[model samples]
Target: MTSRYLDYSGNMDGELRMPGKDKHFQNTEDRTDSGLDSLKDEDYNRIVSGVQNLCIPVSATPQDYEPEPWKVQNNEDGDTLLHLAVIHEAKDLAEEAIRRSYRDGYYLNRQNNLYQTPLHLAIITEQAEIAEKLLQAGCDPEIRDYRGNTALHIACQRGSLRGVGVIVQYSKFQLPSLLTCYNYDGHTCLHLASNNGYLAIVEHLISLGADINAQEPCNGRTALHMAVDKQNPDLMYLLLKHGADVNKVTYQGYSPCQLTWGRENSQIQQHLLSVTEKSLQYLPESEDEDSSDSESEHSDDEYMYDDCKLMCQGLN
Candidate 1:
């Protein structure tokens, strides 16, 4: 037994290259090659399939691929696709989007980062047809922007008679309230038209039931008051013709005729004077004089106190 063990150790180098070990190594190389070839085949199949798909003509309906309107918004300005479409005057795309999302109030009326809806941009861009489509699609007419201006307010500001007509025509039921809607600057659609001397627009708005005598919330100045302030005789006459209240006064109790006092448009001033009540023709002199006197007295007292303080400091 000792002789056999010693012989085995002595033959270690030769035993390592025995047939069984050589066979095992050969099998491993064959299996590795087979695995690599299988991987290559799979990769080739994938490449071929991708190319086939690219070359094949696949017919699909628009409804199958159209993205949800609510999900399509600009990352920077929060403008919906409809907003950009309207801005660029892409009538077809804008109309299609409107048709798809008209019933989706949250989408159709969605406001951008600037608080402008597609309807607002439509009128801003002077796309009266698009504005009409939006209105007909049930887009809200009274939605306000960051400046609290509705699309109708902008139309009036721009003096777009067509735009105004479209908005009013589609929003007939909301006309009474929409015409009186005020922006953050306290201007109704009628006020904006009057202030900007859009005589035709003013008349159209009035005929559509806009309040002729609507007053600005900031100063209680009526459109008539604004007309006189701007010295626009034509606008003033239009207001009068439409039955604007001449006696309607500002928060400070200054009537339209009173506002015309220093204006150079004598025609405006005299006409307003003719229609204004005699009692309101003159400014409330006593009240204004008393308030001004009190302010002057308070300022005088502050000045006297400061003079006295300086005198004491100089003496010290």
Candidate 2:
């Protein structure tokens, strides 16, 4: 597995408010009241107690007692009922907490100890249904965890195309940003998907316009390099078909083809070489309009010689 870039300093304390903040809040309150009206009083009480037990910390001293639920609630780690629900995989509890948050106007995007929101937890835990619920409830998918990974990045890392779809569809404002998002390691969604051999996620990401050739910050290695390095010929072919630049070299000047050397992916090297040879033919004419035919012929010969030399090196 590729190394994960997970780290953070101080805990971030904030939340993303939905658009039309005041109106959304009013609507949420109304919907929550209607939902509560539909439930038996005892059921509602149980849900409230469950949420409180999971989210609110108990008072160690009498002086710590506060009448305000918002003030008194939240564990020492800052995980809300929603966060706990996703972490515990309690779908019913998660849905109830979501309702309560809407009813009470809680911060849906609040970061816990790990700086992950309820939505992030849902996706990370592979609860696609809950993840969808969070998105439909307007949880911000763009919120980064401590590791600077948005829900989209995590979805890709986990190879959850369904989760990715929910994010891509719901995070309208964050879509463009999400497509280009880089985690702490500078790995994009495409990079993660390809590295992990998640063909479905890769296809979805590419269709959504992920930069197929985006390079990692540390190595400048694109998805193609990762695919080649991982000896995934299928992934390599997918990347190539989607317009990944075959000759793109990393900071160390090693192209995907070069990276395949000494690896067990002779097929990948051969495909890259063939593609390179074809691309060379389309190179813009180097000669001026008046330049001699001989000069153009010489340039073509040199290009072919370079191509042959690279092929020989690859074979060796």
Candidate 3:
């Protein structure tokens, strides 16, 4: 009845050794005389039950297991699966993620490290259909990127007419507010479209009820003023045709016509002049008592503002 135990030392040889001793014993016991024979039947059954309880059954299908919540988010840029899908142009995967998130909707609006939601990336990447799907899935069109430009603003800036149309249509009750929402540079969708000379996008925004006369907060320049500054006669004409106030003046007291003074686009200048009030047609006199104010305004770059400089460069 001498007891022996399986050797668990560094050796691979399957020799039995007594506890507290270095000598090896031959494993000559009959199978029935092994360690299991020493345990009571109930003890053996209990050990078996414990092992069975600790075992986890393998899932029959991948769908049967849910992943950890953190796995859904990309570690690098905090982009979720939906964001990555849109970024890589994996439309089917994006659609699937969107479908699964329909009930939660929170993930639909989740922004990545750049504060850009999947919808923003969709429009920026020119995936109009995916943008629409995101909008339809309750993605908030109002969510802005780090630049404070909403998806709609990006759409207009990038001259994506379909992007603009889809965002406006899906915005439903929020369409009017969204059209007028300003980015960090104080440029609305209309201003971006107008500044970029996106005549079609400007027309589309105006048709959708964007405030044609909405003044950018930076210098109080309206879409009309921007069109004049860009010297885009077609855009100017479109703005005027859509009721853009030609008399609208910048914070510097220069009307759209005044902004046209040194520009070479005679057509825009003449059209603005024809419509602008006579008093606003002339630039503010440089020698007037308010000369210092006008001088200070001129010292700053007329078209450049904070992050807007980067945006303009990107658009170009």
Best by TM-score: 3
Q: Which portions of model 2 show Cα errors greater than 4 Å?
A: 1-72, 103-106, 277-316
Cα RMSD of all models vs. native, in order, equals 24.3, 16.8, 18.2
Cα error of candidate 1 at position 171, Å: 0.8
Residue 114 in candidate 2, Cα distance off native in Å: 0.9
TM-score per prediction, in order, is: 0.68, 0.65, 0.70
Model 2 clashing residue pairs (backbone): none
Residue-level lDDT tens digits of model 1 in 1-316: 0111111223322222223344212222344343445556578567544533333233333455455645465758888888989989999999998888755566678899989999999999999989888888788988988878889999999999898889888987888878877776667899999989999999988888889988776457888888877888888888888888888877667888877654588888777778789988865676456867756854875576556445533443
Would you list the C-alpha lDDT of every candidate in the order shown? 0.76, 0.73, 0.77
Where is the poorest 10-residue window by lDDT in model 3?
A: 1-10
What lDDT score is found at residue 250 in candidate 1? 76
- Better candidate number, 1 or 3, judged by TM-score: 3
- Can you rank all candidates by lDDT, best first? 3, 1, 2
lDDT of 3 by residue, 85-104 (tens): 99999999999888877634
1 versus 3: better lDDT goes to:
3
**Which RMSD does model 3 reach against the true structure?**
18.2
How does residue 313 of candidate 2 score in lDDT?
38
Clashes of 1: 0
What TM-score, to 2 decimals, does candidate 3 have? Answer: 0.70
